[model samples]
Each structure stands twice: as C-alpha cells, then as structure tokens.
Target: MPARSYLYVPGHRPDRVPKAAASAADAVIIDLEDAVPVAAKATARAAAAAALRAGSGGTPLWVRVNPGADDLAADLAAVVGPGLAGVWLPKAEPAALARLDDLLTGLERERGLPGGAVPVVALVETAAGVLHAEEVCRAPRVVRLGIGEADLAGELRVRPDPDRTELHGVRLQVVLACAATGLPAPVGPVETNVTDTDRLAHTTATLLRQGFRARTALHPRQVPVINAGFTATAEEVAAAEALLARVPADESTAVDPDGHFLDPAVLRTARETLDRG
Candidate 1:
C-alpha cells in the first residue's frame, strides 16, 4: 500500500530522528532543506548522515535535499547509502531532476548499491514548477509528486482561504500530471497548524477526495489523522465486501437486496475499496 503519512523531522534535530522513525508515520523524512538554517547546513548534513547510519527501525527514511548545486552535492554525498529510501527534491523542475538523477546514479554505483535503488519525490513549489509538473513527474527516479503550498502561495502572492480552496486548481493539476504519467496520486501538502487536529483531519479528508493518497505531516500528532483519512473505514470496507459478494459470477451486473444496481464500474470501485482496506 502507498504511504498514508510522512512525518518530517528537521535534520539538525538528530535526537528527534529516531523518535520520528519509530512513530506511527508510514515514512520519516529528515529535512535538510528549508528546516535547517544556512549557518547550520553542514551540521544538519552531518546529522542526517548519522541518522541514516543509525537505522530507521524498519520505517522508510527519506531525506529532503536542497536544490542548489553545492548543497545538493553535499547533501547527497552525505546521505546516499543503503538506509536511504528516497530523496525529496524541493523546487523540482525537469532539469534539476535530471541533474539529481545523474548524481544519484553515480552515488549508487560508488556506494555499491543497486542501480536505480533510490527513488525521488519531486516537490512543486513555484509557478514554473507547477507549469512543468508533468515533466517533473516523468523525470527519472521520480516515484511520486508533492506540492509545497506554503512556498507556492508565497511565490504566487496569494493568501489562500482558511480551507485553502484557492489552491485547489494547482492541486488538481498535480493530480492530473501524476495520473497522466502513471504515477501514484500526489502526496498532499503539510498542514502547518500543529494544534488544530480538527482542521488537520478535515483537510486530510478533503485531500483524499482530491486524489491525494498520502500527506506530508509536520508533527507526529498529525500522523494518525492523516493515516485514518486515507484508509478505508470499516463500514466502507464492509459495504464494498457486501457489494462484491452480491455480484453474479457470470454476469457484469447485479442487484443488491436493497434494489441498488451494481454494474461493472461499481464492482471495480468495490474491489478498489477492498484493496485499499
């Protein structure tokens, strides 16, 4: 199954790394970019390397690398290893991802790892990034796509509504790009209001309906909410199972006891729901 929650721990906070990995989060992303200050870049990079060496307690460990040439070089050099699950490329564009793909290729070979072992999650944060979303999604090693709404709003100079309705179009664009490229649904943006559990759950549900299967989480507290939002509820699973059981073996259509018609499409949806459960 696809990841339901990705908890991001700051690279500089090495103490929190293991804790986050052990959390209920489906994945742990040690952020080396944005979260780490300029003066502490080197320190954060070293800390990230150490965290990778320490192991992830069986949880996937990803690193968000800076987009700059120098920092990208330093970050990948420090963190690329067997423990690394993938790289999150910020401000992702096709060209930058090509460079990243080449770098990761060389690093994998040098580290004696299998070729193409490390995947990438391309983060679209700027107007250019949005416009080139499909290209970025299609880039080598890019296994998934994500939106950085906070940064994108800053770039676009638009303050979104409380529900973030204004960014819906961009989010759909990302979803379409992923679908067009045969990639999984995009990971949703991080909900920064750490204390607002209600809002977090509401927005995560909205994202799930908007074609986002997973969401990046800023706090461990948000992990369960996100995971629950993405997962099929027991009632939903039971309903799907019932629908499937009512279908006739030789027919593409059937009628449930409640007189509801079940067609091929409905059967497919039921199967998908069961699979999700």
Candidate 2:
C-alpha cells in the first residue's frame, strides 16, 4: 500500500489484463463501470475474476464495481475471494459504502477468508458525495477517497477545461477530507491521451504537490508518467536526508543548514521521507 500509481484496465479486455498486470504501475484497477457496457458487465466480471485468480504477485489488484447496480452483487461474488486486494467502489456514498462493507464482510465469511481481508476505496463524484466525503472516508473499510472529475463536472454542469479550474475546489475538498480522516488522498482522472506525456506528467506533479498520495491512469502509457511524478526525486530525498541529519535528536526545532527555521513537525516529515526512501 505504498503510495501507488494505479492504472485502469477495462475488464472486458482480458487480453490487455496481462500486459496491465505486468506494467510498472504499483497497482492495476480492473474497471467494470463506465468502461464496460451494461450488456457486457457479466463478461467483464468474469474476466476480472479470472485475472485475479491468475495472481499477479507484488502488484496490488483492485476491481472497480458498478455502484448500486443489480449486477454488483454478482460482481462482488465473482471477485471478492482470495487473490483480490480490494474493491474500488465507484460513485460511492456513505450508504452505498456501508452496504458494500456488509457485502464484503459476508463474502469473507462465506469464503472462509480472514475478516476485513478486503478494503474499499470510495469514489466521490457528485457535490452531495463530496460534501459527505468525510463520512464516506470514515466508513469501516474505506482505505482511500477517490475523486471522479468527469462525472463531477457533468453533475455540476461544467465543461472539462485543460487547467481543471472547475474541479479544483472539489479536488481540494476531497484531499482535505482524506487528510482529516487519516485516509489516503487519491490523485486525478488524468488525461487518457498517450501522446500527451508532458501534460500527464505536469498533472501528476501538480497532484503530488497538492498532497495526493496516488493517481489514476486510464491508459497504460500514462503509467510511467504518473509513477515518475509520484516518486520522490533524488534532490527531494537528499534535501530531506540533509535536514534530518542536521537536526539533533533531543532538539525539537533547529535552524537548517540553509538558515531557515525548522520546527519539530518539519523535522519529523523530513525524517519520514528519508525513511520512506
């Protein structure tokens, strides 16, 4: 669960699952909703379940389920067994997540798996959902709070601008809510265009700066850019190490080598970053 760069692969495209599972991404999300048509939900669910069973070790595997759909029960039953890491509950409200929690709990018990074996990642897409994001994040199995910008913009009656000015407030709200709840802040629905690597990198860098722990990638090609953006640069790692090295263990605060005042909180973060590296 280290800060991951998750790439989304359409579940119906089982042929692509192997390549996606073997990709450089920290995790791969097998998508059932939005990516798969209603008619093909069953097929996608089976494909995702098969992929999970194939067992791509090391790389975490998550399945994005259709929220509140009648097919969701079957989807959960198909993929919530062993080898599955977690479920990405899309357009999730607190109530929906609560129900999903119950479903996963039942599945775990029925399958003889450890309790709480599967966690949930809630995707907040609407204004109401974002407003109640804290409650959603606080739900029993929620590991992260995800933002779905496309649906959010449609809900808010706005167009998708390149700079994403319209979604900035909502995105910040999601991040702040996740931070307040001690949950991971999800990154953006970055551009799917493989040719626009520069934009993808820029978007990923911006999200990281804003405290997002992980980002979402629609295309596999965007994986490298997202991973690169989320990774700590050598300079950043060196600076963090240098700051921690200069601080005395007993001293809670001190002036750094650069002559800037460093507080205990700052020193702690520096040490944590170095340790993470």
Candidate 3:
C-alpha cells in the first residue's frame, strides 16, 4: 500500500468501508476505538473482523483496536484474522507495546498467520508516551508512530494555536526518535478543519516542511490534499533525475555543471525523492 494518505472509517458502519476503499486514499483505517460506542463494541468488532476477512478493493484494511486493558485482549482476538494489514495501538506506552507484541505473537501462531506479519502503529498521544518514544519505537513489530494531537493537547494543557508552534517540539521529538530507531518517518496528525480546503492544504504543507511524510484524514476530501502534500512535485522529480544524470552513482562528492554543490547528503536526498514517487 502507498500509505501516504490514510482514511479512517467507523468500524461499526461497515457500509462506509467500500466507499473509503473506492476513494483515493492510500490506506483505510477501520476505527473501533474513539469512533465506536462502548455498547456497540461487540458489533463493531465483528463487523470490522468480517470486513478484514472480506478485504477491500486493493486497499489494506487496518483496525484501530481499543487500548484499554479490559478491551485489548478481546479487540485483538476479534480482529486478528488472515487479511488484517495491521493494528493501531492508541495511547501507546512502552509497557503496553511490549504486552501487545507478546499477544500478537501468540495470536499469529494460533491462527496460522505468518509470524510478525501483522504490524502495529503506535499512537504516541500522551506526555508519557512522548517521553518514552524511543522505547515505544524499539518494541517488536512496531512499524510506525502517529500523533493523537487532540488528546495530547488536553494532557499538556496547551491552548490551540492556529500557527501550531506549541506542537513543534513534540513533532521534532517524534521525528528524531523514529529516525534514530530505524522506523519510517512518523505519520503526521490529522487536520481537524476539513471543510476549509485552503487551511487543509496549508497545514499539510506545514507538516511536510516539518519532516512529516504522511498524515491521517477524517474525510474523503482531505485525501487528495494529503497525497499531494507527501508526494514530491513534478519539478522536484525532474531536478533529482537531472542531478543523478550529471553525477555518477559512485561519485557522491561532485559539483554540477551549473555550479551547484553536491554533497553525499544532498545526493542521498535526491535519490530518496525519486524513490518516493
């Protein structure tokens, strides 16, 4: 899966799965947590499990299971079938991640699924999780991390700033932790103001500049904007190609004919941009 833009649909509403799959989203998240009510947990779990088994049109179906102790075992059991792409562990802490790793291992062996096949997206939403980001990233089968900023802001007592300056340090910590721990760049948090396309695009661009490669979306309309934000521009691709053409692969320390300095880091970045497309 491309994984640049993720669309989250309520798990209890299985009808919405096909619509989300048919959209331009790179991935679809079947949300059992946060979206589904407590009374509907059993129904949503069954619905999500069936959807996972059914599989959508070329779209990977992932489940956001409840992270609480009372629900974790049941939620994981309900959703750990053959077609589950992965699980999203919300409010991720080091201890919880370790416990999930063991549980997933057991479930995989019991179900005859490939061991380590089902990965986890650790949602580092709390101050404690942020402080333990490195340990969380180091946990087995942990693929990537995401920010649940709405919950985090409340925990940190941060006032909502349209400029998002308050979140800068937190985002940097996540990015650095991921880089140091060998995970792909963490997915950016969702933009809440979906109705304002201009604001969505602006926020996406801001996230991109801040080293976020992908983001989550609440609505279908935000998918295109999220994809566009993560993808390298046509001009950027062309420039990278031209740079590679001028410089030999073995020669990372070279200067271009147009007097541009080409260091190893710059060359590596060029290669990554071309690879991203």
Local distance difference test scores for all models: 0.93, 0.82, 0.89
Error of 3 at 88 (Å): 0.5
Arrange candidates by lDDT, highest first: which order?
Answer: 1, 3, 2
Tens-digit lDDT string for candidate 2 (223-274) = 8888777677788899998887787888878897679999988986786566
In candidate 2, what residue range of length 10 has the lowest lDDT sum? 268-277
Model 1 lDDT, full chain set = 0.93
TM-score of each: 0.96, 0.94, 0.96
Per-residue alpha-carbon lDDT of model 3 for 1-277, expressed as tens digits?
A: 3479889999899999989999999999999999999999999999998888888978888889898877989999999977788999999999999889888899989988888988999999999999999999999889999888989999999987896789889999999999899898889998888898899899988887887889999999999989988888999999999887877767767789878888878888888788666
lDDT for model 2: 0.82
Please tell me which predicted candidate would have the highest lDDT against the true structure.
1
The model with the greater lDDT, 2 or 3, is: 3
Give the alpha carbon lDDT tens digit for every residue of 186-208 in model 1: 99999989999999999998998
lDDT accuracy of residue 16 in candidate 1: 96
Report clash pairs, candidate 1: none
**Candidate with the larger TM-score of 1 and 2:** 1
Model 1 TM-score on a 0 to 1 scale? 0.96
